[model samples]
Target: MCLLNLIVRLSYVDHTQDVSHTGRVVELKNYVRGLLLDSSGPLTKVELINHLQRLGVGYLFEEEIRTVLDAIWKGKDIEIENDLHATALRFRILRQNGYDASIDYFNSFIDEMGSFKACLCEDTKGLLSLYEASYLAFPGETRMDEAKAFAKRHLKDRKGKIDTRFEEQVDHAFELPIHYRMLRLEARWYIDMCEKDETMDPVILELAKLDYNILQASYQKDVQNGSFPTMYYRWWRQLGLVEKLPFIRDRWLECYLFSLSITYEPQYGYGREVLNKVNQMITLLDDTYDVYGTVEELELFTDAIDRWDTSAIKQLPEYMRTSFLALLNFGNDLGYDTLKDQGWDVIPCVGKLDEIARGDVPKSIQCYMHEANVSEAIAREHIRGIIDETWKEMNKEYVTDHVFPRAFADAAVGLAQRAECVYVNGDGFGRNQSNSEINGQVMSLVVEPIPINNV
Candidate 1:
């Protein structure tokens, strides 16, 4: 019986491998796509789109989704009833997909007293939808700010009193808003939750499970097949930095997952490798500046990096010398690869900046606080503003095609997005499991594999 079990497991693996290589995935894709379009009402359609996005399979039906959204946009001028859930779902989805969805529709939800109607809290689902939609607010949307605060206060108050079904959802929303979640990780979480629902289509659930497992198997194989882990392990060993700087994080896996989040398609293997190496270097540099290196040593390192000269490493302590050289060599090699492959001199972009904080031993935020003579809270607000602007700049580069070879530009934006997502709560990658939000992300994406259904 034991032998039979082993044989069955092996056969299952082979079957999944065969299925991944066949037309079944394509068929499943269409099967799911049809369900998305088959929804009867606009509310149902928008909800389906929302589910597809959260499930991370929306990419497979991008064109169809766009058509539906475009139609919705054309009908935007039409006044739909102010049913909170439907209105908020339509508003969030529309704005998220680049439609000019006005928050004016929410005016109906407000009472004559200039507050959201008190009675609306009874519909927890509608309140939850409104809470989620509030996050899509742009600058100067005072209404959204009020809505968010109102929704949150009510949700927290009702946390214990609410039904068990709504309790988990409310807690999750409070912990991490959907706007900030990584797509694939959210999909994994949502798929598990969705599969148990009797209302969910079994076919869609099965396909989602199978597709996720297949990709996970591919990712597992990637780890075994590639030199990434080996190269990172050697670099960490050779640098001896982890032992030397115990305060710094030793998270090579998280760095690689950051790369995976940037571009998960197997075809972008080279891009992923490049990103992983780059992220590894950035991680080391962040730690060196934030924890290990003395201000003076950091100043020297900063100067050396700016000059892009190896001889400057002579001024560094013995502990710092090898890392400087390793960073320099990595940059040179990357430049060479980019030049040879894309005919682009990437060295200029790669060497454009180095971190040099003044008036603080550790954080750049401290420098801001010192310079501006503000409290930590004010300084953090300033930092958030800077991040928002940076995102705008990144988006501009993508839209205007300011960067050559769109793939690199997209990867650059993706890296920026991933960094913001991970660090939004705190320095998530500073220490593994330090932040539950990112820890959940790491576990979902890297450590855990999806359990296949109907295998």
Candidate 2:
């Protein structure tokens, strides 16, 4: 109904070329489902499930995959294949999919010294499987810890010594285990890898490629349509943050990708857009506190944010007025939207958070650095350990029911994962908005659509 909505969002992605793509996707999906239904062996079923998941079309076949996995999730080895690679792959996939596949299943391979037999070192696929699954272990799984160490030490040594094709995946898994990588992004990368894999099922691969592009188009449209970031960009331009403040900058893509990492399902557009706004706001406040604001000025800004009132803006510095007012407007808009849709006025729930008290001012990394009197590197290691611990805790929570919406819980974890991704090598927000890691990730997720070629 507005001028902004009038501007179409073609993004050079043509639907006419893809008119048959929709039909092909449905056709291939049914074929894959039939394979799941007819597959006679556990090995074939589990392997197909992994391919579906890694190729990103697994979501399309969730019901079939779930039904198959439920049938295959017998905790005993009598039903599963006896080999290390098959068993380890099943363990990792099952655990990841929320089944309590025990780490004890791997005890048969451990020797008297509690070390994984050197025989496993010769089994490259088995070692890779073990290495990946070890990361999924909960706290106090010492055997898994040993498994990781053993697998990692050998995998690194055997890196280039194996088949060139598998080595590509070895390098990928070594950089970051698939468990930690966001799904949609990982799928983009894996789709290419799966395409190159000679044994990959053609129908399934075609479905993955097509479904990815289809959902990707939907995501891009979300970026341009109702509750649009393009609309937000226009508002941001109107805000004149870069011009007036001369420090505030736009990070719409990064924020959107961060939100997508939270949960990329097309149905979660409202939640994704809202989460994008939250990320953008965090960027602005982070810049104000860390890059621009003086100690005294930050104190004033913090107080204004705490008060959540226009009256406080009267006492603030000239440059601070617009940022503070914009923050208030954001809160008000969210409150208004919540009421209009849900019939519940949540303005009362609006409250200022992150009022760090005294010694609590030091966050995890800083706290570890000061408390242990360790180098920054060591403190960073300590923080990574905390992240790993938190993940295990979340893994425990993930298997149980929670009161929070699934999206909320997912976004909470995704927020932490985004921080890790953005800041992994260095500032993902900084460095000209391009790095080999995030630049490639963003391109895969948003910028470049997968080529819609024939299978």
Candidate 3:
């Protein structure tokens, strides 16, 4: 980390005494709920709900949010032609929460010249909202592509005309759309922005900051004393992954940030530990396929994993043995815990990791292109289809009950979701140390706590 980044991060010091605002949290949730319920119109309600989500408080009132969105779904009273802000906000939030919102509604915003209406640029806030919403577009949504281009071009053109705060926000959003950002990190950013907005409720501002600080306190405690730093550090050194491979990422901090993003609640410390270790192992296997191993060696590794025998280690190359052994030990420990706690052995789940490994053994698109006897585009599509189907299973696990504890299950699904987010453009993790995005995440969520108000 640079000195400036280090200084900025360290500024968020831990408070000497822990802070808890249980009563105020209840009051704040009630206040937000009442506001959601009492909005004067559909547009107002949608806007309020969007604020709740962007502020990261919507999780506290899921049913209330669903109720309002349901009413809007039934009424369908939004005037896309007249009010672009409400229409875009409604479209984004509804689709994000799984409503059938379509980008086709933005047809009215385009002119005969096939560009967004020139006059619409004057509605800068609305344009920014539209830009944010365009990110939620699905495949084949050409109108959304146009909207993203139009909004981004105009937002950049008007940068100097906007206030510094708004300029800063526009730049940040342009770099990363909120749809792609983790919710808690967005909350940390928005809380500062909300402090400057005179219209925001002071109580909501206070509570959001407090909740953020308290959570940061818990995560920071883990940073200092958690098993992750001490144990993983020793293990990684012992495994000799860095010196041996020299290509894989040494990103324990970034991996833990991923764990926190999945389930940041304080009580899920064990879940974080488990997820972090799983992430490390996944990184090991991913590198072996994508970078280190040749086709024949990867075949051997995959076969050994499939056999699920202690003797399998002998079949692996000398460099692959320790990594494979570490993975097996993790499975053994995890399976034993599952048996003791849930009364079921997860050795089957452990065993199935080989099946997953086999799927990735092919590695590159070249393998798919040759094996499937399809064009490159078609081969890519097949992989995408697999990802989409996997999401359905992950989503099923997310909402329905399963053998794993709820928190661990959530973390498991979150790992999948975040992998999609990070790797959507490409195999970023494969690039390892040069990826600044994961490094920034480590700085924001794990290395730094949100600075709290002294009063």
Which digits, one per residue and each the tens of the lDDT, describe model 2 over residues 1-455? 12233234345546565668888777887888899999478888888888888888777887888898888885354555457788788988887777877787787787898788888787888889888888778877778878888988988989778988889888888877877877787788898888788888777888888889888777667555545656666666677776887686567667767878887887877777677766666667766776787889988887887777789998789998888887788778989999899988765444342232212334668778888999989998888888788777776665567788755665666666676667767667665544456556755775577876657
lDDT of each: 0.69, 0.75, 0.72
Q: For each candidate in turn, give its C-alpha RMSD to the true structure in angstroms.
A: 5.6, 3.7, 5.7
- Which residue segments of model 2 deviate by more than 4 Å? 1-11, 79-81, 223-227, 344-373, 434-439
* Number of the top TM-score candidate: 2
Ranking by TM-score: 2, 1, 3
Model 3 lDDT per residue over 367-415, tens place? 8899889998898888876764554444334444457775566456556
lDDT at position 168, candidate 1: 79
In order of appearance, the predictions have TM-scores of 0.81, 0.89, 0.76
For candidate 3, the per-residue lDDT at 282 reads: 77
lDDT of 1 by residue, 106-207 (tens): 888899999999988777778888888877676567788788888887777777787775687787787666755555766787887787667876766666
Best-fitting candidate, scored by lDDT: 2
Supply candidate 2's per-residue lDDT for 405.
71
Worst 10 residues of 3 by lDDT: 1-10
Comparing candidate 2 with candidate 3, which one achieves the higher lDDT?
Answer: 2
